[model samples]
Target chain A: MTVTMGKALTAALRDAMREDDTVLMFGEDVGPLGGVFRVTDGLAAEFGEDRCFDTPLAESGIVGLAVGMAMNGFRPVVEMQFDAFAYPAFEQIASHVAKMRNRTRGAVGLPMVIRVPYAGGIGGVEHHSDSSEAYYAHTPGLKVVTPSTVADAYSLLREAIADPDPVVFMEPKKLYWAKDEVSLPVRTEPFGRAVVRVPGSDATLLAYGPAVPVALEAASAAAAEGLSLEVVDLRTLVPFDDATVAASVRKTGRCVVVAEASGFAGVSAEIVARVQERCFHSLAAPVLRVAGWDVPFPPPVLEKYQLPGVDRVLDAVDRLQFDDAPDPRFLAVSP
Target chain B: MTTQAEHRMPAVLPGGVPPADALLPSAEPVRFLDDDGGPAPGDAHGRYERPSTELLRRAYDAMVLGRRFDAQATALTKQGRLAVYPSSRGQEAGEIGAVLALRETDWLFPTYRDTMALIARGIDPVEALTLLRGSWHCGYDPMATRTAPQCTPLATHAPHAVGVAYAARRRGEDTVALVLIGDGGTSEGDFHEALNFAAVFHVPVVFLVQNNGFAISVPVSRQTAAPSLAHKGVGYGVRGERVDGNDPLAMLAVLTDAVESARAGGGPVLVEAHTYRVEPHTNADDDGRYRDHDEVAAWKRRDPIARLEAHLRSAGELTDDDVAAAGAAAEAFAADVRKRLSEEPVGDPAELFAHVFATPTPQLREQAAWLAEELAR
Candidate 1:
């Protein structure tokens, strides 16, 4: 069935709730208003306010409450109205929910999901457009999942909901309206698996969430120049699919990881490290990373430049193209 | 806002003789069950019952077990098995009494100091130790046991309890969420938020504030200008009550009523379990710097466990043999727990990287790899 990423997520949640009475969804504006992004639209009406409802304007309260509910045999899915709004809730995520399972000696499991609408393309204010996945990914006991396509949005979300641990589900706000033809009967995929979008032998472009489209566009641009560029969409950030990323890097002999998070300590850093470890000898050049600037996500006017775009991916490819040809520049930098 | 000076009225001392409305807001403490094991009528709220032999026996058992667990955990910390331990020695009845009154399915969100409550809620004693050992983020499975992880930050877990109760009420589940916080926690924003939310939603939660009078170095007098912690609940529009935390029967009666009210969907209730912490906040804190010895001595006279023991003996529920056996069992249990904790292996540092995510992010993998290499060198 064809559906937008938002529609697919909503449908997936609807299906999950239908299948499991234990599943519940709550957040600000999620009940009567269907969430700010309408991701939870019609859910409260269908599931009844008991299963899906609005909460107070407190993010930490939302996540903390969900932790308690999950402890009580309920699978709670909490939504932070926007990425920026999730900061207040970070304390609960880090201090309590994330560590509950291990702290409780594996006796307590937090079967909860925190859905965050992240990234910029919609002229959102600073707080609305930021990508803070790195913060959560850095945290222990949280499973971070971000889907690029509708199929992934449907499948991975279902998997996240079913997982016995807490999951931080990041939905790219930019791609909310982006449509794709998704097959009916959504299949659940294991967390930390990457999907190969386009296959090529020259170089590999690894990206996830909204950046997948940019990587694909870069691959197309590279193809026109007689450059075979492979595109990889990382469906999950935590428990990352290192084997797939390493294999792609080994096959292409060069790779660039693209993400909307800042370059410093971002998800791309992990991709680079894995490629270096598994595909070190096969590399034609050092693995490149195309990411947002270290600064906070820029305002709408400058966000285009601040975020990693197709041009940045191509630039990374341009730098990697000279790996086989040793030049004066390499020797000059050796000293 | 009232100035701090204006609120510095000396705490009205409880008279040597029990008052008519001691537990009520206007009175000091209504001692239905006195320290001398004599029966007295409760405040206008209700009359006191001469508890049955079985109930008194159970109360004694709970206190002994709570004390044993607290002692074991303290020993574990001293032996370097746990990172830190907060002794719940003198505060046993304040926690155990309320916890024992809870229904099996009722939720509990306890603070770091409420180790006894966790023990009462069926968490493996060793697992609770594991949390203090800092080997895991949560020491127990909250989902399976209806108890949340020990909240280190003060009062943060209170709102969670309220929220859970709210959710339970929405789902038509007759479950009550009980949250334990310290006097210090009442100063935090989350505390006020939780109370306000509970009042607004009429969530079926019981906010049990164990007012041990000191939050780390700060005394209760410095924490707020309100006459009492129970009065703070009035601002939230919830029914508030103060019980002599040292009186186990009083705590049980109040907590039972609160739990039942929550279960019946009546609304939230705030209970200020007035007690004192005989020991320092934790092994790391020093009470000498902040508190007076005279104050400690005064509170010791009202020891909850000792009073309950006196009551049980007077009621003929507890025999000398029963008391001796309970003491021996508690001591043996504590020794066994200490031995097992000493034998438990120290967790691998790399395990820190595990469980953050179901799948490690590439970046975390890289950092973990880097740490592994660095450690190898």
Candidate 2:
């Protein structure tokens, strides 16, 4: 079947709720109004008001209630209207939902998923376009997953729902309208596994969520330049597939991480650190990153410049190509 | 205790109970149990038949163990084993009473000081101590025991309780949520928001405010002008009541009614458990700096545990030997917990990055890899 990422997600949620009596879906405008994105348009009608409903304009309340419900044996999937709007509930996510299992010595589980529409492409205002996955990924006890393809959007979401832990499921708002052929499997796949969206050998490009498309574009452009770039989509953030990433990086001897979050202390920093550690000697050049600017996501007019693009990845590749040279930038640096 | 020191007393209502014939409704608190451990006149409000002997014994034992655990935690703070400890020494009855009123399926949202409530709910005292020791985040699974994490930020969990109640009611589940906060917490926006939400939605949640007369160094006088925290719920259209927090029987009676009422779809209730913080706010705080010694001594005479013990002994429900045995057992249990706590390995710093997400982002994986290498070096 061919479907947009948004439709796929809605179908995935509907199907999951249909399969599990305990499954519930709730968020702002998710009921009679559907969602702002219309991803949850018919859920309330299909599941009844009891299973699918709208919550008060309190993000914390939505998440906290989900935690309580999950504790009580309900599978709650909450939707944050926007990425930035999720900050109010971040405390609940970090202090309660994430740490509940470990804090209780595995006596309790937070089998809930929080769906957030994130990232910019449609020129959303400051609050709408922000990418906050790094913040969630930074906190322990949460599973941060983002899907780049229609199939991944459907399958990984079900996997998130089935996992007996809190999962932050981020859907790229910009990619919601992007359509692709999807095979809706009867069952969901396991989480924490990375997918090689494109295979190559000269260099590796690590990306996830919205950036996967950007990395694919970058890979296509790099291919024309005779650079065989391996594009790796990190399906899940918390229990990242280090083996997959390390294997790719080790083979290529060069890697470039891409993300829409701010460059400083972002997911890119973590990827760079890991690559440097595991494949330090294998590095043809320092692991490079193509990410958003350190400044806050700029106004829509400037966001295009702030967010990483195909040109940025190719630029990073250009830097890696000069690894044999003492690179003027490091001339005075001690080994 | 000092024969009512004859200094000009705050205007006392002529009758034993404040006269209802005031020009305006008097804000004087209502109490079912008196300071002398006797039921007051017109105390027919929500008295319960005495719980089974087994339940009473369990409650008493749990209170003793909770107190012991609190004391051991305080000592551990002094011994440099814990970062800090909040003592629930004199306020055990109110906490235990409320817990006893709850069904196993009901939920509890407790604050940092409600260790007694956690113990009454069958949570291992040592597990809570682990959080205080900074070895873990929250000590127990809120789902397994129908309790939320002990919220340190004042009043934050109140809304959570309301939300849970709303969810339960929406699902047609006859469950109730009891959220415990302090008098100081009543001042937080979350408290008012929670009360308003609970009332509007007719959610089955009880806002149990343990009015201990202070928020850290700030006295109750400075916290609010309302005669009682319970009155705050009135504006939100929720039933509000004040109970003798020191009287375990009285608290149990009121809480049972409140819990049952909520389960019956009677909407939210606001319960003000008027008590005192007999110890410093925490091991790191010094109450002497803000409160006088005399005031502390005065409140000590009205201690909740002591009052409950008086009632129990006078009623022939418990003997001195029983109390002594419970104390000895609690002390031994505390010692064992301390030993176990000491032997438990410290958490690995690398694990700090482990649970943030179910799967690590390529970026986080890199950071963890770097941290791993740094640790190795």
RMSD of 1: 7.1
lDDT of 2 by residue, B1-377 (tens): 10112211322234563322211111444454466656555634343454555666666777787788878878877887877778877788778878888999888998889876887788887776667778656767677788887888788778778867766776678889999999889887678868866765677898889988789999888989976778787676677877767766667767888899889867788888878888899888988889898987887777656666666777788898989999999989888878876754488877665554444455567778999999899
Scored by TM-score, the top model is 1
Per-model CA lDDT versus the true structure: 0.80, 0.79
Q: TM-score of the candidate numbered 1?
A: 0.85
Interface DockQ of candidate 2: 0.16
Provide DockQ values for all models, in the order shown: 0.24, 0.16
lDDT of 1 by residue, A91-136 (tens): 7888877876666655667789999999998888778898889898
Name the lDDT of candidate 1.
0.80
Off by over 4 Å in 1: A183-185, A188-190, A321-335, B1-30, B33-54, B68-83, B118-130, B133-146, B159-173, B196-201, B309-377
**How well does candidate 1 score on lDDT at residue B9?**
26
Per-residue CA lDDT of model 1 for B1-377, tens digit only, reads: 22222223222224743321332353454355665545655552354343456665787887898898787787677777888988878787778877776878888888888888887777888876666776656656676787777888888788678767765765677888899988999888778878766765667888888898888888899999987888787666666787778888777777787788777756677888888998888888878998899989888887887888887777677788988988998888788787777776567778666655455566677888989999999
Clashes of 1: 24
